[model samples]
Target: MSATLRSIAMGDGTAPVDMLAALFEARGWPCSADSAEEISGEIQGSWATYQVRCVWRAEDRVLQLLCLPDIRIAKEKRAPATELLALINEQMWLGHFDIWSDGGMLLYRHGAMLGDDGLLTLSQAQALVEAAIEECDRFYPAFQFVLWSDKSAREALDSALIDAAGEA
Candidate 1:
């Protein structure tokens, strides 16, 4: 970690959620802190604009981050979406994609334990947010392929991964 991150994580006494808010502000990203425990922001990715939310659970000493695209899976497409989510999740090292049963909303979810201090280092918080966005952006196109283009889950995932690898 850099000296600034060390100081922010140790000396400033910032809560995990507040740290996220501060990080977003420093990046000049628009965000809102709905409460002491939660912050929501937006980020523009190559595929789409994503909604990012960070929630700090004081009781659990866990910080959760979620990144969601603007797309919604239709009821009939949920099966393929779920399969694509599973296939995509298996390839991810940091976060996993999930579809909400209630709303058919698909998102990438990740959590980090803050340990005894109940604080997140600036670098750690930044990584969590970045990982979420990266995963969502990477798979957004596959999701479109599966849900809208009638591609099989495996085919969609394969195409997305191949495209990503080529770009990288």
Candidate 2:
């Protein structure tokens, strides 16, 4: 940890906004934190551009990141979207994809516990953001396949994973 992070982690009464800014700075990722609760920015992925939002809850010692794309499921395709989310989430070990059925909004969400006794350190915050972005980018194409094509959830996910591996 850097000296600044060490000081912040030592509970120097730093604001969550400052801590978040520092965290992203340490990781060298650009962000905007004009609000106290969250930071919002665009993360460029291999296949897509995601609008990433990082929310902090200091009272609860928790952080959440939501990666949202332009993908939206039609009303008739809600069931398939739900099925895709289930299939995708099963293979995921950290974050999970979710659908807002009524609004047809799709998002990849990850939550991390900062633990009650400790400060939300720079490393923990960076890890949470990294995992959320990685999972979101990796699975974005599968969600697109399910929404735009007639592929089944299993097929879409399998194809997406194969493509992701090829990229790696």
Q: Which candidate is the best by TM-score?
A: 1
Per the 3 Å backbone cut-off, how many clashing residue pairs does candidate 2 have? Answer: 0
Say which candidate scores most in lDDT.
Answer: 1
- lDDT (C-alpha, whole model) for all candidates: 0.82, 0.76
Against the hidden reference, what TM-scores do the models get?
0.89, 0.80
For residues 58-146, could you state the per-residue lDDT of candidate 1 as single tens digits?
Answer: 99998888888977889999888988888887887887888888889888888888778897767787788888877887788799889
Q: Over 4 Å off in model 2, which ranges?
A: 1-16, 25-30, 163-168
- Residue by residue across 1-168, what tens digits does model 2's lDDT show? 667766777763345556777776665667899588888877677677778887878778677778887678888888877898898889889888888666788888887766665356555666776787788778888888887887898888888888333533
lDDT of 2 at 45: 72
lDDT of 1 at 12: 37
